[model samples]
Target: MKLNQFLRTALVACAAVFTIGVSLSTQAPTVSASSATYKTVATTSIKKAPYHKKSSAGAIYNASHTKKVANLKTYPYTTWYATAKVTLKHGSSKALYYKVKNASGSVSGIVWNKYVTPGKSPFGLKYAKSAVALDVNTNNNVWTKNPNTARPIASLSKLMTLYLVRQKIAQGKGTWSSKVNTSNAGLKRLGKSNVFGGFKFNHNSYTVRQLYLAGLIESSNNAAIALGQWVAGGSTPAYNKKFIGMMNNQASEWHLKHSSFVSASGMEQNSLQPYGYSIGASKNANYVSASDIAQISRHFIVDYNDILTDASVKSMKVDGQTLHNYNNLLPGRKYYQKSLKVDGLKTGYTDPAGYCFVGTGRKSGHDRIVTVVLHDENEFTETRSLMNYVYNQNLA
Candidate 1:
């Protein structure tokens, strides 16, 4: 989310990448009793045909005929009021298209036949250059301007740091209450060039809890390195090597084919070479597909919720110096959304990753969605826009 991890005066650290860019429910949310309900009256070339939502549409385009359309996670039978066999822009083969209103009863739009039937949306990390949004529970159900592409994930890699540390705690290897000092190796990372969210590494010692919180909350670079060292067997280079392996192992365990991690904190490996650390041959920052990132967040929802709740801390006293979360959407903050039940996941940024956010929120307490925005110019606003589209459908 920022270069200097130790302190944050504001959440405006990542340079915006905004271009533009969810499933989520089947029933059309009814707003008022007076809203119109049409009893199908077939006439002309029109006929009512019901169709099931495709289990996976890799993406939902706006117009369904060409550009982008908002996608919902809902998969109930949709009543198509009209259908027409037409040629579309995406390909040369002519196919049937439907103008259907989903069960949610929000306004209707054009939908291609394949997405509603036995066929599914196209797949891959296809469109990740501009942005990507995903439904946490569904397979291959996502929206992206560019999927099937590899992109930098910046500080989002800290999610792995969060996961691994919590894994150790769950294993009784360490506890949040454990005490750990800022290793000389960590302190040396304080002024490394190209590192972000910088904070002065003044204190030599802090509770294990403090350093852990700094990595997730403030995205403190040194705090992440310090925690890596601590868990890597008492701040030794050899152990840290093993720790990095653990991170990759976790990714492999998740079957994230397009994802790779060279560091625990998501900083580019070569960028840190001046500080005497090399991340082996790739010399890259962490990389993850938008879909895998969504799944990673879903894993957070299922396994590491304590980290999520702690991450929702808009402000916390870390060693008595308050640090603010970079995710501005957390409730009670100036940028929070009143309509959406906003909590948190994480945020990331770097020159290569552009401005990225792995944002999560829900409404009515259960329909959680994890959205990944990569290479965005306006990470926060664009993320809010995508979340709004999902919630606005009244699917939840």
Candidate 2:
């Protein structure tokens, strides 16, 4: 009897220990953001929690779970970088929430018990004055800041020009081998200081393919205008208008709401006010939102795989002249991000737009990503940083 009793007690003690261990293993930790613990934890950008708001911020989600704003609760503790502190009226006790001011301006919302993580904003989004980042396959907006605000896009305009030229060629409206005569404007553009990737009027006429490549590779204003004229039936005023109309029509077809095109070369031109906001001056330029530019990049890659495949050409041999590709993000080039599998895309810049880039890259175990940056002096830096954050966060 004594032996049996002892065995029973031993078994009970062992079971108790086992239960305690299991309980410890199952429980998650609670730590503040400022706790030296932040370094140990994997930190990323601000993210919408996987969970949904059971009730809107203003609505009372409280200890008692009542509708009264006073009934809303407040958390006793908060971690650093967890949630932005906007002054919003909350309940007297628990589940307190406040207003959050987004880039658009002041806004009202509830910050629940577990909404935003408190800590340093690791994404460096403050540097992105106007930008959009997304996944190509899902078409999801992974991250954006002032994405709808339109701003001038310099040579990035050439992407559309390239697309149109290819479309015309595909439809039998234009041919690569067809001889396109350089206009007097094209000739006069030579030796002008404003011209980029320009040649010195060496040839009277260039093949359609040569002109198109010149614009794409070298970002030559002269080549782009020449191609535009060719598309417009020889660069006449009426013909140019017809071509410009086509560009607008294409933007519409793509459902681009904020993008407007005035010139094929992405040179500065007057833009219309999509939103009536003025410091008493016009917001005119080749305006396009980061979101619109990102979509364009996604569509360009999906629709024309050849652009990615053929973007490897560093320079195009046009008769005797060599026009170089300006995209430094390409493989084996300077400013290349090894982690970012960037094959092809375009870059842009102007006085108003600063520097812009439409970048595409593939991350491991993920689909392609399209990133657009505007109004940054170092476009390359902004693009690379954003790409790194997106891939690391796995937001898509």
Candidate 3:
């Protein structure tokens, strides 16, 4: 009897130890973002936890869990600083959550501990005033850094011009073969300057197609102005005013509230004045948020996909002059990646705008990604990083 009793006690103690070990193995070690030696602990998938509000899983909430402060989708692949821990009731049981904030302190809320781990930001994005990556196929605003802040857009104004020209064609008002004369004195002055990529108008005229290709592919200031002039009927001061008004009106129609345009060519008022065009404030340039530009790019590729044929072409022979694409990520270029079929979009620069790019790419049998890097001299490099990161992330 004594021997049997001892065996029973030993078995009970071993079972107790086994249960404790299993529980310890399941609880991950918590690491804060500020930890000098950030260590990661593997976390198991969490079961649904109840909250007082009708909240869904993976939501960041207030202290009392009565309101959801943010959805995790907005900060994709971000490494949040875990500041505090709190225990909240989940039905008859309790669960733990960590209070987390972004490095800038702009985003702060409590999230379930399973949603975060101690590590660097997965994006590792830098070298730009503002940046963003959006998935075209899913329509998910995948990731952003300073997305809403407005900055000068420079030659990107041509995108709006292209959109309008397409609209004009669809309405039967014009065709690609239509001739737009570039014989005005201002055009002559632009050609003399020569730095603006003004078309050498042999007959002082180019079809809408030539100007469109030059403007889209080469960022030609002269081509942009001529296209706008064609749209507004002529290059007179009244026409300049009408064209700028149309640009703003179309922006408003799209509800791009953060976009403001001053010139059709995206040049400063002073620069255009030398070429005999009057528009917005002398010092003011075209200011658009990176997010708004991304939105515009998304609409562009989806509606006017034919723009890609022109945009992806590295060079085009226009009136015996070769126009090379400004984008470096296209095929057979500096930043080209075979897997990342980067095809179309735009590149912009001015002293004020620095270097800005709206780049689009897709992997075969996958959704397209639209990326933007604004006011950075290394626009191409940063855009590549943003695209690579967003593609690897689960934006959900």
Candidate 4:
């Protein structure tokens, strides 16, 4: 079958199938978005449908449980998108199929797949699975899956820690030159065999600025604990509690419902090993959505850049061992040399969380864009691909 012809037939077939199940209100779920209307079909049949790629832009889709499923008791009348829109070729056609299963044992809804033509914005393509893209310059938000779904933030939690520290510094309670000692207990807690295994610090003495540099630049866990301890008077737990409170306070102040924090370090409990310690467990760590990340980035870019100054940003060295900034895309060509206005940002990863980044960059005099990728498998490739898509297609 010709691609376009096949797509038309598939769309018609899906529509017919969805129409039959529309009256099965208890079984056939209805999903409504500002941009489109969706009807649910059988959940088991989604994997059987074939999908054709119509564009070079990336796409993602996942069959995970909808966030609504968890809150059905509270929001009984809610709707869910069974199949999200993927980009298509102009004047060409493609179709994908999806099944939407309810919390109960039965199939509740089916998604009649439709394809969207690529937009003018290069970065406007749909990401497969649960993904979202935003252009702060135009207030343009595009998402597949639940864009506002809150998930563990991993090391991205450090941005908030840095923010609070900066706040204290601004209030004259602290300064960049302020020195803080690292305790044996703090070192022991941070010395767990993970990212911090390479650091060989004295564990007895370090300045606030020194620890801050290590925490933000190299993402040293000990540095993070040390800074938190210093802030809360040599108690990591107390400091962590206050730090989380600060995060909640910021969330409330910013009207962010999907933001929460439980630890300064994003560690959580390990499910695989009942006794194993997991760094940034899904249950006990910080959580935030893509939009929340954008909001926080805006605060950093527009409001708090002064705090993360070039001097302080560059001042990250541990015991005279200078740590190279992991933000490889920052204003240098070693990673993506030449004409890239990429500046400082944070990167995070964990087994449960996958790879995540909250990156910011600019193109000449064009609008500054913040690109965030969460729960990505190959974060480096994904980040470069997204950035290339934005620079070549969207921002250019």
Candidate 5:
């Protein structure tokens, strides 16, 4: 009986040892995916395929997100089907990544969930160097990309010029009908330069309202300079200095730290030599941050809403010709949208600034959003996308 009991105990021990061996054999090195908790999304359950849309540059990785499989540009406009979403440990936090692939399975990889959106490929400011979108009424920043970096603003400087002139008008120092003589030889010489888009001001003169419209709508450098001269009482060197000081003071009053102006028209310092202004360097031009531009637009629109009367006008008769506005987002313009009520804002361009735009739009006239894009290859389309994103997302 003792022998039989010992044999039974040995058999039991052997069985336990086998179980341990099996468990050891099945053990695996902890993989990235195994360490991460994830959920598998059924292919049929997906209502909309996601498309790659990123605010910044990133890459697609393997399932474990440990290996770089592809760059973002590899699958342009390719709709992705998400197979799984994994929440991976990243430093002290966690991030979600989606396992995705194209319809034909040609493109497959893991991408950050923030870099994609559902539905069709929408226009994005991804290519723009700097951008911002803000809700004017609530002072909510909807979206921003390098907003505080100061860059050449080109014609956007005119907005400040307009603001100062409007201030003078408000202070009872000038009227819209105030006539500004353009008989200065330097002013005439600058006006004749076709590249700057100025009118013939040799022996001619224009009212404050006309010059204002010309500067805002027509982007006339001479008209802006003429107005600046009027404000400073002359186009002499001392007067130009005074006007530039005024521009800087106004910016200070507005609390804009990333803005400086050398010319009222936003021309480079060398370009303003016709006005007795000495050229310093090619980079000596108006510099303003995208954020500051948006703020300036908000202040101008809030205080001088009437400027939109001329700003919204697509074309105005100036210098015996129809001068069309450079802002293509206006109604009936190149990039106009029926859903958005885009009104007066501004557009600017230069070699250093590229193509820049400060656009304001309303969904129902009560909800206004201001969008700015700088150094954009497609300013109008990007602006449209920003406006649409703000309104559609209800970010405002």
Candidate 6:
């Protein structure tokens, strides 16, 4: 018989046993009606002799082997086959139908379907009231809370400073190897109470690339002031104009309207007054939204990979110290998995800005996620929590 027909018959027999319990009267159905086609022949069965005989070779001889020929009758044993037909319903129509049965008639070894539910985010940051996440590769927005609200970006604005430097480099206005002389005025500006303490001396001579690296990976205000002065032709007004222009240009390109840039460094001189100190400004600081920072990060990953790939940006060593990328996620830690494929990014912190980070990582085959946290009280904990949440929800 064909395989399908055999399975159908077996399923029917098994279904009968399952529905009404197995019985001897439920014999397997015959497919053919003609007795000649399914003929039974007479056969003889041999009987065994009595035990307790040994061979000449010293091996014991069994009863059947030593028994004499004798006439015997043969009979076929009874067997039952049952098959079951199952129908799966979808709405008002039957979706799928199949037959199943027990091969041994015991129904104990039969296989069945197993169901499982999908997993959710594991980091447990879903309760956060304000969070923004975007996948740069897919441009998918995954936000748990308020994502568009304006917030201080802190040193994250240095990304724009680096962007402006790259812009100048692309325009042939500046070269990576170009040397920048730090003056007394520039050092004083960067050494202000609100600025970096590293910028104390006027004799510090660094290349454009080194300054950019310091500003980007180390958040060095001195380097930012130097670059800003270089871009402004050693004039504060000139540099501020170009800085704001570049910021607006980037904002427009990235479709970020809620963000603005007022300084190369993001430091607000003081909160009590409208005017604050920046790289060159003695006024209020720059501001940007979390979304804009994410967009800028995407641009760096896509359009400006060369900036990060440059030898100067990669292996920048100055003052007997080698500068590394500020992104802590590049080298995966014990608490963070290396499988997340996280690369270089930026981090920011200020009294007014709190702690902020723009992190990016690729997942699966096509999923690439970017997370931005702004004005976080506990940045270390919140950053890890948000990163874990996005990785689990979007990548895992």
**lDDT winner among the candidates?**
5
TM-score for each candidate, following the candidate numbering: 0.66, 0.64, 0.69, 0.60, 0.69, 0.59
Task: Assess the local accuracy of residue 271 in candidate 1 as a C-alpha lDDT between 0 and 100.
Answer: 64
- Clashes by residue pair, model 3: none
- Give the lDDT of residue 260 in candidate 5: 78
Deviation in Å, model 6, residue 195 alpha carbon: 6.1
Badly placed stretches (over 4 Å) of model 2 are: 1-121, 190-197, 270-284
Give me candidate 3's TM-score against the actual structure. Answer: 0.69
TM-score of 6: 0.59
Evaluate candidate 6 by giving its C-alpha RMSD to the native, one decimal: 22.6
Clashing pairs in 5: none
Question: What is the descending lDDT order?
Answer: 5, 3, 1, 2, 4, 6
Estimate the overall C-alpha local distance difference test score of candidate 3: 0.70
Error of 2 at 152 (Å): 0.6
- Against the reference, the lDDT scores of all candidates come to 0.61, 0.58, 0.70, 0.50, 0.70, 0.50
Clashes found in each candidate (C-alpha, N, C closer than 3 A): 44, 16, 0, 18, 0, 14
Candidate 2: tens digits of C-alpha lDDT, residues 57-99:
2122222222223211121111112223222121111122322
Q: Give the per-residue lDDT of model 1 (tens digit) for 329-387.
A: 78775457776666887888888887778887765543677778787666666676666
Q: How many clashes in candidate 5? A: 0
Give the Å error, residue 356, model 2: 0.8
Worst 10 contiguous positions by lDDT, candidate 2: 1-10
List ranges where model 5 is wrong by over 4 Å. Answer: 1-124, 279-283
Cα lDDT tens digits for candidate 4, 220-310: 6656655665665554455555656666787788887888876565554442122122334345656788677767766766667653354
lDDT of 5 by residue, 276-307 (tens): 66435345888889999888888898899887
Local lDDT at 361 for model 5: 77
Native-to-model Cα distance after best TM-score fit, residue 379 in candidate 4, in Å = 2.2
